[model samples]
Target: MPQWSDYTNGQRIKILRGREITQPQLAERCGLSVVTIQKAEQDKVLSLTTLLRIAGALGVDTSVILGQQAPRRAMSMDDRAMLRELSRAVHDSWVGLLPRTVAAPSADELRAAVDACWARYWEGHYAEAGAIVAPLLEAATAHRHEQPHDRQATAWGLISDAHRLAAYVANLMGARDLAYAAIGHAQEAAESAADNMRHALVTSGRAWVYLRDSRLKAALDLAEKSAVDIEPRFSRATPGELVAYGSHVNFAAVVAARLEKKERAKEFLSQSHAAGARLGEEIAAHGTRWGPVSATTQAVGVNVGLGRIGKALALADDIKDVSALSPAAQNRYSMDLALAQAHARQWDASLDTLEETLTKAPEWSRHQVLPGVIVEKVGRASTARLRRVSKLLGVSNPVTGGFDTATEKSAL
Candidate 1:
């Protein structure tokens, strides 16, 4: 296990300083006494409230200040409820510690913390994002161990999200084995919790792993099962919850298309689009964090699958700020870009985008598998095509392979 002590005290100070605010200024912003803020900066221990306030002032979630690491053992139902209670406790403790401040957080506050982390992960900032939820996951897991099985489901669901983000970061760094290990840990957490939404996310993540390893059949099977399980559950869920599941299905469809299973791919695509439609209606009725999955974005991959390269390329302009989507969504964008380039026989452009995706992605394990497989396949395919084209054109040195401006532009 890596320790914060692994970095020199100087480096640690630098990292903190990089947050763009002085201790006294941060204290003022967070309404903390200058003495308390100075204490924290000088390595003196303060109340949890003070620490949390300082953390917030620094623009980091409280979890970042806590020395929490990866997910641990699974939980039972009572344990799950305890974890939820623990989350409440941590937040309350933070709130009560507010420098001369007080107010209990609403449900939105709790959800917002998680959502912020999600956005960070989307932007390819994994380490920072993972830190954002470390405390919540740690507290929940610790509480679950002490509690009974009554609320294990809810607790695990929450913890699984953190693990999911962790896995995504691992994947981004090209650590394939690490990525799978993280996913396994998260899967155990979700299964123990037994929440369908969490289960769907875990199952879909696993399916992507299989797809990354080129185990398309296994990927399709896992996706199919997840979609089936989630359909009936959607009616009982909020619009945002339903949209999350739809995103998972859309992810599975992309894998199916990669395997060249035309009918199966089309089938999954239909299900994915249909789910998106329903989710969109729900989001419109009750405003969601992000709008519905753009029909045009989904169609891009579908068009590429059908070999309508020009059509897919034409729609590429519809996708705005690829970095703004979730990690999975960003990966999909990269995959779609590669697929579009591949269909158009622009081998160089495809490889370039693949390289860029690999570069900008997080270091989570969950995000690793599919992207690796895609890059490997596209690289090999592109290499073969280049060789063939070179031989046919009688070019003496037809630049064997390299990333160029075309790829970087697409990645941006």
Candidate 2:
């Protein structure tokens, strides 16, 4: 209900600009005339350039200015198929609808399988990841129930992770309700297992769900609290502890940046960087990764959302290598980097970054809002290049900041 999607574009801009910044102030920030700002607020047709300027000035995604993104993206066919099966597995497994005839795998085998699925997901092979987890959800659930009451903790934790994996994939594909349901089940299982590490992990996972759902305050609160609860005493902290703590604070920084609490986001970023420094390199654990690379990459995003474009670009420049990050993380960094580049008026560089993001992860890019935004800001774009990029991203009209899902389907 607090989201901006229900409002007209003009109203959304005014609201995002808020009471603190008047039209003149916004105009100054956007480097446009006050008349231009006034006309925009009057609901006149917004050129892609004007809209992109205002959206950047307001520190929001372009889609958020026009309205939220379309209720759903055009999902890849393979992803849709996998989601169908994933949805069935999530629902059936949650309601105690275990397949009676299925042979259950060992707890260790199932645990490794869930981790493998997550690895596939991070590699951006989403459908393949979903294929592994779709049936694994049911199997994990069935196996947990088969264990003796006193011996079920391991199985319970496995079920929680399996469900969490399902939620991660589903959430990215725009299956919000399914993601919520899967996460609900994941939390319940984690609680039942009484695993401290999993409790924090699930909490972080749920916070991510809240962020995608636009539950901004909830996401911030959950992430901050979970981070505090798991904060490591530097002298004695282990690698896993450091990873979880760093990931939590890094997410807290993300939410804070999005909420425009620039100073608080800065503090969290410092902590995240320190945690990463302690680890010296990326540590993959608990379905996530954290380290110097993770912290620095996320810091660029935080700076971008806070509208510190120069700072974002500076941080990005220092990140000489990103191969340590996951494929998904790399694409996401390219998104933030592109936005920073666009805001800095390095239009060519921005477009090139956008090209890299989409070419490297076309299917993964489908669900993102940033590509379309980047296209709108490319002032020097060639018609043929724009047409190709738009088709690749399925953005029929960047002026309105919405994708045509049908068009997206055909572009493939």
Candidate 3:
């Protein structure tokens, strides 16, 4: 009987890939060169970034790919049944397919429904959010059509938001094509609504889709353009406008950081911080979250991505209100904190943080990739502690297969 830990990383990749995809096909799927794919399977030079992208393209838990899964922890919004429904809803609404005759909710009711789903999404309840969003998309489309001429635009705006939510959940699920379609419809609906701020927000949303797709240059362009388009006059800016502007700049910074443009990333981050200062506390508008806490929290990740581990840790200390963030945000911060500790060679501290976060948010952690990365890089941790953490995350170490821990830098 072969345990997952018994197989080298390369062998595991080969087994998982099976006969379904050739090396070049897998290379194309991962957006890497064929030689890179070959190297990975040969266990020649597995960088954290390489493994992360590979796991993402394969739509599997990073831990599962890293090691044995005892029983795989199926997470990361990979609810096939739910996603299938969500997909059908998105495409159906886009092409005007519906239940022959549909009754549209009142504008207030429709908006409230969309808000609730967004709430669920931010709470890290991705599957729950998708379940609700499927029906909401269908109803919102109906509402957009059934509303009176004067109220039509309002209905359209709601439709845009629903699609945005769909895109977001789909993106995290690694369903890139579906995410692109959903956001495309989101932007179109926003245009029909004729709301400039809403449209700009949708553009940022699309930039995020691009970011996840490894379209760094394109993502940066869209994010920067949107930020400039809505560059608010600070003193007179409304909270919504500030949040929108902050989100765009923050994303631009994130993309810039990934692109290794240090100064550009810092510049956009500073703008985001200013916008957050003006906006004060965290707030959600147009289904997106931004404000002082979000801006600061995002800075931690930006610094981490830049390999400024000490700066990242210092920034982590400054965040006093992480409990106030949405579940997903809090989990993200925990990963950053853990990664920082791991990079500092504080292996036990990193594992402790990961253990605490995973125990608290198994569902969200299951779909994420960073946990595996953290464990992999904590090379000095005790075997017992490491195995416990590995079992918890359902990941196995690839160090024996020549994975490069020193190369654990880049987009998460």
Candidate 4:
């Protein structure tokens, strides 16, 4: 019945660890030194990466260790269901269980369906998008086998897109293995299509999977190489080519920032910005949203990843219209902004930003670790307003100790 705010991070770690996990065991599981675990449990400072690892090893969301919420599975029921369906689809494709003679949708219809799936995904309707992708994959796979050579190529491209969408959803939900498999499906489809752009796009998808799994160097290398492979002569580049190249460069910047390669990260961001300027408007290509606005938004996160918090804030100020971004991108940018505010000790503003973002995209926020990270940073200082924010995020207040079980539900 105790309130979440009643405990410090150290206390929460101890409680979560309990008698089941020893310091050495946790350290081994989290790939940290025993001393690090001890220090963290003593309320000493730990890097965000280290904290995230510990949370992952403990099989709980970061919010549990941050004392913002109880231990819980990271994925929602919908996410788990989607992962299951995707897994089954991938397995069926591998085993040749997909219907061999289903009526294939027209090329235009297939293209429209894929486009709709991407739109739904970017809009934060992840589960709905996923539902559309499963059937599309089956249909595309059938078409790839049934159509004549000329038409089959198009079917392969659509199949690649469907699997790419699957990979995107799986990665976002933290199902790494499932994402890896989905990407494999996409790569196979891309190869069958014999399209350089499709292959480059799948490479970009693989880079993202690597990034999600903490293979930072691999991600950077692949993203950079893929960008270069698809880099059209800017003067002659089609808008689609511009978006493809810019998206890879944007991802490369992200990975570089994570690796602490500040100059390299900036160079990538600049390249992306140049491509965006040429494109002259927001565009979606190969399931990625890219443009000047997208580059600027990514730059904010790269700066933050490089510990250039002030620069990140400055870049954020230039984004005068959050509405210009898709819901997913806007949520991500807001998270970066909230983190910067927290690092600057502007806790009130951070909470406000976080509250608004979570309200706007509750389900998406539930899958993210940054919200919990910001909450932990702000919790270092006790305030009545902070308690209110905690309650809003479904964490109990310390002063009151407990809430009626029936009344204590997460706003998300």
Relative to the true structure, candidate 3 reaches a TM of 0.78
Q: How do the residues 53-157 of candidate 1 rate in per-residue lDDT, one tens digit apiece?
A: 655554433444453321111111222233333334333422222222233333345356667777676555555664555454454455454455785565566
Comparing 2 with 4 on TM-score, the higher-scoring candidate is: 2
For each candidate in the order shown, give its overall lDDT on alpha carbons: 0.54, 0.80, 0.80, 0.78
TM-score of 1: 0.54
Candidate 4 shows a clash count of 0
**Residue-wise C-alpha lDDT for candidate 2, range 199-239, written one tens digit per residue:** 88888888888887778889889988888888989879999
Question: Which wins on TM-score, candidate 3 or candidate 4?
Answer: 3
- Which residues of candidate 1, in runs, are more than 4 Å off? 1-112, 133-136, 146-149, 232-237, 281-293, 314-335, 338-342, 345-412
Show model 4 residue runs off by greater than 4 Å.
1-74, 99-102, 149-151, 391-412
Name the better of 1 and 4 by TM-score.
4
Give the 10-residue window scoring lowest on summed lDDT in candidate 4.
403-412
